[model samples]
Target: MSAPRLRVAPSPTGDPHVGTAYMSLFNLGFVRRHGGAFVLRIEDTDRARFRADSEQQIYDTLRWLGLTWDEGPDVGGPYAPYRQSERLATYRPFVDRLLADGHAYHCWCSPERLAQMRERQRADKQPTGYDRLCLGKSEAERRALGGFADTPVVRMLIPDDVPLTFTDVIRGEVSAPRPDDQVILKADGFPTYHLAVVVDDHLMQITHVVRGEEWISSTPKHLLLYRWLGLPAPAFAHMPLLRNADKSKISKRKNPAARLTWFVEQGYLPEALLNFLGLLGYSQPDGSEIFDFAQFSADFEWSRVNTVGPVFDLDKLDWLNGHYIRELDLAEFAGRLTAFAGDPAHADVIAAAAPLVQERVATLREGLDMIGFLLVDEASFAVDEAAAAKHLGEAGQEVIAAAVLALQADGEWAHEAIEAALRGALVDGLGLKPRQAFGPVR
Candidate 1:
């Protein structure tokens, strides 16, 4: 048999979340390792929040990480028109079929009614989804409620008391309370994500449903849909959530690295970023830690990845980045560093400082700070606390002034010589111990 078909479907919205990259890397690695086709599906059905720029970002970010898809919007595959929005015509037939089979019914419940229903359920300490209010509506009543009205949505009637079960690849043997009924199609006539995801997964022949652990609760719902549609449920592997260092949900609002753009701006190598993300929930089965893309793929046995939320330690990631950076040849490093540097005023200093900071830094911003002295026009440079104490005090002021004058007299304008001259003045001329003199400068 051909390798199992796998995919990463991401929603196009505002900023590209690190979560998207994390999930993409996992799927890409898994599919590639098994010699399966990896597909990219764009789920942009939520037209209100849809952004045109998001598509390009998705393509750019994934390609930047060297995660190429066998099929996508930009590339051809068996699943042509690989976007959910373009497949609305396909969805309508399934909705109609569900209604005709009596597996689903017309839901004419209004939002006001839903709110009231939720309140009643809350008072009774019961669950608060739809109450299937329109399930019992007469044919005449259903006809009356029809004709471009917002109330006539389509809902699947879920059977009660049949304990639905599916073996999860991560959290095994998952189940949930089968709902009385579910809205397969909203009043606006758009399919809900639950309906769309299941329908598409079946249609796409996706073998593995690799996703985050939060979706573990929803697995039963998907399982119900599969059975109702008379289709086999795909194997699932719900990987752990990537968390903040504080163990909270990883959020883009709170963390810069949570957004991929920040990492791109900071000049993080895409491969390094991918490797760091992989380390979040997985490690070598034999206990090896250092992993590149190929190594990660070689060791990606789904059973080895954790089910608990993995802490996104940027410090740990920085260490990984250092490893990736060291592995890169200087020419390759220089090319990448140039891209993120863009049009900075002091590109020369940055170029010079790149190698020096290469061994010690995690980000290009850190390297910029190392060459800061070259870029800083000291004529206009104001005194920060250290600069004030080190150069502005009575003794410090005289020494700095003398040093500046002496340095100005025979200056080859260079950072190293300038630093050496300043040190000589402080230690030799000022009669200050090196530690005492450099302490304030530092």
Candidate 2:
């Protein structure tokens, strides 16, 4: 069989979501294991919520996590225009075919009318969906009846016997709730996700569709489009959602960690973040919690995926990040610290202090904090007032005077000799405990 093709289509609507990375990891992992192409498609058809800069953030954050795609908007492939917005012309033909075949029809129902319909459905405890108000009506007939819009949106004419069950790569046979007449194309001429995704995946030859379990409900709609358009459907694997401590689905609006950029800004190593994400829904055959992407790809299988939603445990992430941080050599660690600090002038200081904090911090931000005092000039440095009050009393002043005299008298300038002299002066001569002696100086 030809190598499979897969893609992660992320909407550029807001901050690049961690869910995007989660889906990308699985998509790219499967491709890497099976020797296939992994594509990145931008689903930017939602004009109302779309942001121009968000597309670039998606590219940047994914790359930052060390995730790459064989084809994307930035890296052109046989599928040249990878973005949904750019391929508007490509979908029109499919939409026309669906309409011509009686599989879909134009709906002139206005937004307000639909809202009121949903409101009534809620009041009546009914399953809310499109009412098919303008199913067979012309624009003139619908306008005359009122509650009509000037431009009509196309809706799929879902049959009563439309299949509600489909095969999932991970979950075996899964059944979804019966769907209503879903809108396929908006009045603005932009195809909705159902139509655009079906068209793109079929054209791009995506062999597998990997996404969060939240999309399982929408699978029937996509499957219907594939069947109606006479296109082969890709294999579906709906990975479990990442949940919060309370088992609620993680969302960027509720948790900053759900934003991919939050991990970067917090100085998490990409390898660590990738490894953490991998462990969320999968485990290595060896039963290890920590493994890099290469190992993950090598051992990936749809069957091994855990369907239960995994809690977003940050303590595990921090532990993994600390492990990765400690694995770095001193020079490399210092270099990363310098880059993350975004201060070239502090390169030497950070390098000198890297050894002191490399094993002490779980993140570059923490490393910087651990050695922040060393980075500032003496003029700008100020002692913490609370610490000063606790350690700068009369007894502490006496220890400092003795430590100064001992340092001045010692000829050797090495750390060991200086430490010995201070210990002898404060710990022995002054008879103060080590903590008492070191408190003020530190």
Worst 10 residues of 1 by lDDT: 142-151
lDDT, candidate 2, 220-306, per-residue tens: 999989888888999998999999999999998899999998998999999999999999978899999878899999988889999
Against the true structure, what is every candidate's RMSD?
3.6, 2.6
TM-score of each: 0.87, 0.92
Candidate 1 lDDT by residue in tens digits, 81-183: 8888888888898888878888888876666667778899999998778766578786567556533244577877777654567788777887655555767
The TM-score measured for candidate 1 stands at 0.87
Which pairs clash inside model 1?
none
